[model samples]
Target: MLAFPRPASSAFYRPDIDGLRAIAVLSVIAYHIGVPGLPGGFVGVDIFFVLSGFLISGLLRQELLATGSLGFAAFFARRIRRLGPALMLVTLVTLLAGYMVLLPDAANTLGREARAVVTLSANHHFMKHAFDYFNTATDLKPLLHTWSLAVEEQYYLLWPLLMLGAYRAGGGEKALRPTLLAVLLLSFAACLSLSYSDMPKAFYLMPARAWEFAAGGLLAWLPLRHSRSAWHANALAGGGLAILLCSIVLLDEHSMVFPGWVVLLPVCGTLLVLAAGGLDPHHAPGRLLGSRWFTALGLLSYSWYLWHQPLLALGRYYDVGQRDLLRDFLLGGVLALFLAWLTYCLVEQPVRQRRWRCFATDKSTLWAGLAMSVLVWLVASAAMYMPKKYPWPGYQAILQVKQDQAQLPPGCDMPERGVPLSPQASCRIGPAHAPLQLLAWGDSHTDHAMPMYQLLAQAQGVGILRRAYHGCPPLVDAVPVGEGKVRSWCLNHSRAVMAELASLSRSGLHGVLMNVRWNGYTALPVAGSASITGLAQADAQGNVAVAGAMLAGVGQLDRAHSLQVMAASLDRVASQLAALRLKLVLLAPEPEMPLSVPECLARRGAAACHASRADVDRQRAAILPILQQVASRHANVRVWDPIARFCDAQTCYAAAAGVVRYQDQNHLTASMSRTLQADFAPLFSWARQP
Candidate 1:
């Protein structure tokens, strides 16, 4: 057996650990800032989890081995000193920034999140509110990054107690090894299970995350034997680092369910590096990690993590230039580094090092920490309720847009589960006595475009039947499955709706106005839980599993494959409708804005509240071709492009005539949708006649 060096017994600073810290923080920053070729940069938080477990467990193990007991108060005091001051400082600054730059709704959110940060409950708060960490909307939240810190703190609260219990259970430090191993196994099992079942719980809760810490804690107890050669140690550390690099390269936000099976790569990698270096800091990995630059960045990692997100998010919120994302992040990074240095030097170093005798002891540190936390909490509470009192310029206009944003009238859209295809009285959009001539079919996009349909129905004196299942596109064989909670209902609803199309045609329904967000269905699938509308292919016997093939154990279909599947489905559906003498009018996709129009207007005002026409065109480049090809194939099928109505040559304006045009990123507001009657007149006239 190759002898691996045992860790040194005596306590000493490990520069290599600092280097590792530097790597973790930088990876996170790079990921958040949209750094290219580093989509898996989020794995940095998992790395931090392991590092914290190892260091904290090692410290407790050392104390138990020497003194046979733990000093709970002293440990917590040290932690408070290390974490509290810098957090309070950042929260205060973020709060002031919120007050100055944000609208009432956004300011209130910042205030609420600020309280959660100071109270160390940010993980729970964000878990409830922010469903997906990778969601684009979450990029606007400055305090969102604090959830990881909350997880670490929550783990520390229970970990030392477990260590103390294990120490008292006999066999001295050896007892801790088994206890940590048990925790590692059990917590990992729970994490794996919940990642599939309840992702938010798995992601944000400490229980599901405890295994990562336990893996690090187990590293602290690994028995080491001194070896003559360093080659094996170098190989082990190199292999570990190679694994981490692979993870960073291969994984992304939607690559896999986060902190699931894939997380083991980073956890194992971190363990390998720490295991090899803990015994001898002279190993190749150690020497590289302990270099001056790595150590310096490591020293500033905590403060940098705290400062960067707020600066970036606030910068985005206040930005009017609509500059390139890379440029925005680059500028934000410089500002964040400067602020982090000031925070580290002015607040973190002074408090943690106990520069004055009065603040030197554990008691003083705890009291000061408590006072600071209270101050933050009070200020956050004030900011929460104070937003309405201080209105910004054009606040009333923004407020009206916020209050009166468009939605499909109640009872019109399908519920999450089960197929409810029957239309109610409210679902018909025309004079009650007028004959129902048209079917408005699609997903949420159709729901958003209802006002235009309603206006046309009333003007043309024809009833339009509204049939919309949220997230389920208008397709026959392509069923939406995987990821979202609504998938089950979507499949059932889609199947039922498609099956009823012939019945509708027999009952005098003449045309189908199909308008869905085509980009979502056609986008390439990554290796994650992002559900897509999949094409169900049949086996040899002409047998098809409406719920089986493509959805069972299959992730989303790739972009080209998905588009192919959708085009085939559209062809079949259009052909079927054409044979039934039903006119098929395919509404070309509306330009999707980069952000919520109302939210953008409230924050950046009217001048800056629009998306680049070039960017919109780029987004739709893949979608338009398939739609055009599908529409051109059938005599009765035609495509209607509304790009000219909503957009000029240069821009797709979010608001027009001081009214917000979009309710969110893609969906049009009722006011804006109503203004599109001129655009929809020809289609409505044709459908009514047919």
Candidate 2:
């Protein structure tokens, strides 16, 4: 245990610290509003955490040294008075605004977040939601910023008790310092470990973040004599500010390692600033921080933090394209400042100053805080369950139609690697005892057609094996590129499905239906190396004679040649299946809508819920020619066009007969798939024959 000299008073008012607060809050606001220069402005939260730990620990240490005891009730009462009123006001206003602007699903999510905020469990809630703090979607969440406040509150809830225990156990402040240092080291280690494996845990949990606070607390507990040399103070503060500015400018959302070792930059910088100011108030850095503008901004910082997010979120909600982003951000900032001033003067100051006699006593303040929390929770709950009335008639029915889309059938399952594909039975639809007549192979597009296939199989007394992997194309040689790298799982799954198809073909499977989102394979770059266009260009330049060698037997090709070889691989597979006397049918791409069917119908009327035929034709042109060329080379292969079922001369219907055709933008709803039975009758009729 280390010993230290106690300071004169627990509460030391520092205008410089308030200026630091102004810097912290402004950086956060600038980052949230998408300011161009400060991509890493989120480090402001780290500054706040350090400041909080220093102030609170210093106050507690002084009380213990002066009174030789802790007043738990009085301390909690002060916290409630300071935090409760402003929090409740912001939450109420945000909730009301959210109800008016947000969709039903988004509104329901807000209500759940509100409940979590009231109980100081918002961090846990957001973690469960798998929220990425730096993602674009986070901008729409009005209460997302409250997670930091929750972390601070949760820390305060238990930190004082722990300090009191340590004070009694060790008999002085000296003994507590080493214990806090050990805890800080351990927490930082945890943060590093979890950040790599489980980012949400490291990002949102208090334990992983406790080291930052403990760093501040340990600084407060240490004995530091005021530096008589003004040069030392100036250098320390100036260097700290420089580090903070660099962190704000250099990092971004795309940086993989964050809130880990990288966080040391901002945390250490903040510590330096605090230390320098504590040592010399009249130093160059200290004098600048204590200036009038910085001090006033610091006074309003708390309220400003509370108001900024909601205003920005609402602004984004109303302005879809964010036309003139700079103007919108400026307007939002101005509104936030106005609201922050109002709340600070009207609510925060009054409550903290005990202007309301009802909350004059500690017990009364606690009760009042709890009562307000309960009222907010009730309002949030009401908002969540409030009857949602859509502007368009029959919208409820369209939603119901989407909901009725069946899940993956009982015997059909696609588990991740190392898991059994299916447990109780084979991936077969129709009669259990019947022989396998048809095999559906592709990606999720095949999964979407399962209900229709099941109906067809039962009517024709034929067993169908549904073998599909989500997002894995049926092509033998191609791999998916996601997040700028080849998806190994997609490659592995494709090989596995192709092996299964070969085995099933040898067992006398009558036919195979290849159903995939063909456009995805053609347009998306393959394995992050080359796209279909690049492949075609290579062939055109005589670098890789893909078209000339279309009928050549399979051979080992360079990895860069994989995407270019996909069309040839499809033709080769078709030829092999044809040799085995099995039929091959390729389902043409469906007309994908630009937006979800429900969103389109609700935003625009049902009469406007159709896509232009020319757009669909243009999008499918590249893939259609490839499919046609493959079919032309094999006698057993045939192409099935579903466009005639949905499109007229100039338009493709998204909804018909009062039913939505799509569950989302691209996939067909089960209800809509079932309605395609007439078009599918011929395939079943062909299978039913001897």
Model 2: per-residue Cα lDDT over 186-241, one tens digit each:
98999988775556678889999988999998888888778989888899899999
* lDDT winner: 1
Put down candidate 1 lDDT per residue, 1-690, tens digits, no spaces: 112212223457788888888889888888888888999988989889999988988888888889999998899888988888888888999998888777788899999999998889999998877766776556678899999999999989998888888888756876888888888889999998877666667888999999999898888878765446797678778888888888777787564676678889999999988877855568888899888888777878888899888887877776521335665576457778777777777777777668855359988877887888899999999888787787565567656665564445567656656466655576777888988889888888887878888888888888888888766777656654333222455556666776676787787788988888876665433111133434443233323344212322244455666667778888888888888889988888888776567767766676666778998888778778877887788888888899998789999888878557886667787788888889789877887565
Write down the TM-score of every candidate: 0.75, 0.72
Task: Tell how far residue 673 is off in model 2, in angstroms.
Answer: 4.8
Model-by-model lDDT, in order?
Answer: 0.76, 0.74
* RMSD (Cα, Å) of model 2: 9.3
State the displacement of the C-alpha of residue 80, model 2, in Å, after optimal TM-score superposition.
2.1
Q: What is the lDDT of residue 477 in candidate 1?
A: 64
